[model samples]
Target: MSGIEIIRLPSRFDYSFHRQFGDLYTPLIEGGECDDIILDFSQVEYLDSSALGMMVLLQKKSSVNNIKVKIKGARGATDEILKMANMQKIFEFI
Candidate 1:
């Protein structure tokens, strides 16, 4: 099933992640095409609740579809946010 699709967001993750999440993530989840999803946060500097909410939504949707959502390259404030949300347990971080 190719596991997961890699979607790269812009460098300014704090500003653009929400938009990108909606534009890129919604269709992928709704399509029910893959069992795993990976979001590359290498370029992301920060993440807020909105981003966290999106992640939760994605994970929940994926769970229902029997998919796994993994996150990679998260650093700085972005990483902190994920930790604060306790999303590391839900997502495989790399």
Candidate 2:
């Protein structure tokens, strides 16, 4: 079974994104036994440090659980930010 599935965040990925993550994604991640995850960032317009931190945390958790995390469809500013932060190397982009 799939571990966690996160769709692309619309527009900005700031506090609202974090709140949504906590409200939605976190529970799914915590409750599941599987570790594989896919974070779709196709429609994201912007992302800040908090979003990056959250990604890192997710990656760490996945690593600890022996899960494979995949990030797909990141483009524009969001892609740039991830690249700048060297996250592109850490995550699988498709």
Candidate 3:
């Protein structure tokens, strides 16, 4: 496995986020080239269930390939949302 691959999230993490990032995400997770996939939420102010679902899907995909899915830069409401979803256990946060 290689180094981490970072995917930065947009301000609003809604359903459309997957559509925009899926192309990059699918191949990266499926390629098995990285040891970790870091989702940067520095700019994300809001996120919905769809976003959470997308993250879970990403987590599953990465796990299948023996890759770690990481969450980074989540703050304020975004952090709270992730905590509320119990995502801290599911993903490595940094």
Model 3 accuracy (lDDT, Cα): 0.90
RMSD of each: 2.0, 2.1, 0.9
Candidate 2 wrongly placed segments (more than 4 Å): 1-4
Cα-based TM-score, every candidate: 0.81, 0.80, 0.95
**Which candidate gets the maximum lDDT versus the true structure?**
3
Give the candidates in order of TM-score, highest first. Answer: 3, 1, 2
- TM-score for model 1? 0.81
Question: Lowest summed lDDT over 10 consecutive residues: which window, candidate 1?
Answer: 9-18
lDDT of 1 by residue, 10-69 (tens): 666553567767778777777877877888989887666777777777788778878788
Q: lDDT of all the models against the reference?
A: 0.78, 0.75, 0.90
Per-residue CA lDDT of model 3 for 1-94, tens digit only, reads: 7988999999999988778778768888777688998999999999999999999988887888899989999999999999999999899899
Runs in model 3 lying further than 4 Å from the true structure:
none
Candidate 2, residue 63: the lDDT equals 75
Worst 10 residues of 3 by lDDT: 23-32
Candidate 1's C-alpha runs over 4 A off are 14-19
